[model samples]
Target: MSPELIKRLTEHQPSLIGLEQCRQAAVLIPLLETPDGVQIVLEQRSPKLKHQPRDICLPGGAIEAGETPRQAAVREACEELLLRPEQIQVFGLMDVLHTNTLMLYPYAAKLTDYDMTYSTAEVERVFCVPLSFFQTQKPEQYRITLPVHPPEDFPLSRIVGGKQYQWRERREDIVFYQYQDWTIWGITAKILQAFARITR
Candidate 1:
């Protein structure tokens, strides 16, 4: 095997940044074996939920205390999909992701069985798409630009034109993907995009 492949197989490390109130979370990229081929499992969050209601997502949530992201990923899959631990075989830990405040971990696991009963309170629906679909369909991209303007306070006392200093704007790229009737976008899309590249 190539050195890079070896590294990817061996490096399953976690990172914690030095920041307060920074939540750490994890998600499972549940791949199911089938007669046609391997497929990816995804979930739609319950509309009644407070966060990301009715959004299409992977089965995952916050990493509990004294638990590794790996542990959390499996626990979440079990909790959300009503699957036993033995039915899920975690294969690899992918790269970590960062949000405005949360640090997220993504794990790749294979589902040994197809039968599942998702938690109604947390999962609205469970769906699967062929891995080849993403291999063929590319996501649409958009960019958002935000220019920050500080308040016009009178505290610009002893600086070199502090109030008039030029500042740079921040830009973020948004991606969207359409599969028949579903629009997979945002963080979930990003995770799938990364997984697609890894597969390639």
Candidate 2:
């Protein structure tokens, strides 16, 4: 990550009151700069799960009762993708994110090899999309309806099967990526949005 990106991230402070009250979760927004460009890793959830089934998300899991959020983030990445903690360059921490269902700690990591293997039970696939997409795309491109107090709408997009899909927020920050046939809202988008704000 650039020093400018680091500086911007260091100064961020998103509200945590609501987050502290929910189940703690952590995710790593892994970054990689290829000949193609900077990319962010995302995972496609298996349709067999009961919660957030068929969603695009950062590799993560609920924080164990005894672990810190940072530890949870590193552990979840390792457990999900065999990403070793030593291989990651954790650039900076993002603001504490609150989903309607969980409190998420979003951490940033930069790695050279984004090689991944997925468990059919938890993840259906793993993929990467250029970070520039988020930086350059218009807000209208991601617009989608979300389930909120008043039923809100937001944009959603992610690379899957080598295609980009626009998602409509079906609720909160949760969106439905129709092309990939996955819902990507909640903690995942929250993490990406935080990165978008800092990188922009």
Candidate 3:
């Protein structure tokens, strides 16, 4: 390689492969300071929604074009919770999660002056669970297997073993948290698990 080409390549920042092709989303893990302690604000999605309706989740949605993850998280929280931008103070970003089709950015924020308000069009209800609950209670864990399937047009004969080729299967662990009558699982629980680990 030429010296100039090497220098140019070195200056390029490395990022996740195929990240540009992945669907991006951002969420705010809102924290409410109360007399008891710090509570986590969660929402039940509107049952009429097309996506994960009635599912318990943090306030967030798809990252809009040209919007940063932090901006998306704050905007989603403000829209869903009916709070002013000043009322949602984002402190830090926890971590970025990668799934088969999604790239999720979870931000840690403090919600001020929020009065259990939410948009009925997007959220069915808003509730708070003590941060202590997650800090104290362990989530139930389960593993799921994902088998790889080749498309019908895929040329299996191009490989050595043909149809007998052993494709590696992927497995992922899922977590569930039971807080009172609420069942928190899937991506929401996964993010919470990460948060709990860091806080501990």
The alpha-carbon RMSD values of the candidates against the true structure, listed in the order shown, are 7.7, 14.1, 1.0
Q: Is candidate 1 or candidate 2 better by lDDT?
A: 1
**lDDT minimum window of 10 residues, candidate 2:** 149-158
Task: Give one digit per residue, the lDDT tens place, for model 2 in 1-200.
Answer: 99999998999887656656678788888888888988888888889989877778897788898998888888888777776778778876788776556777888888756576666778889887778766665332244456333222423322442223434455333423222443455456556666787898
Evaluated at residue 194, the lDDT of candidate 1 is 86
Residue-level lDDT tens digits of model 3 in 51-124: 89999999998999999999999999999999999998889999788987899999999988889999999999
User: What's the best-to-worst order under lDDT?
Assistant: 3, 1, 2
Q: Would you list the C-alpha lDDT of every candidate in the order shown?
A: 0.86, 0.71, 0.94
The TM-scores of all predictions, comma-separated, are 0.83, 0.68, 0.97
Model 3: lDDT to the true structure: 0.94
> Candidate 1's error at 49, in angstroms?
0.6
Angstrom error of the Cα, residue 78, model 1: value is: 0.9
Give the winner by lDDT: 2 or 3: 3
Candidate 3: TM-score? Answer: 0.97
CA RMSD (A), model 2: 14.1
lDDT of 1 by residue, 91-136 (tens): 8888777765778789999988658579897998988889988877
Q: What shift in Å separates residue 187 of candidate 1 from its native position after superposition?
A: 0.4
| Residue runs of model 3 more than 4 Å from their true location after superposition | none
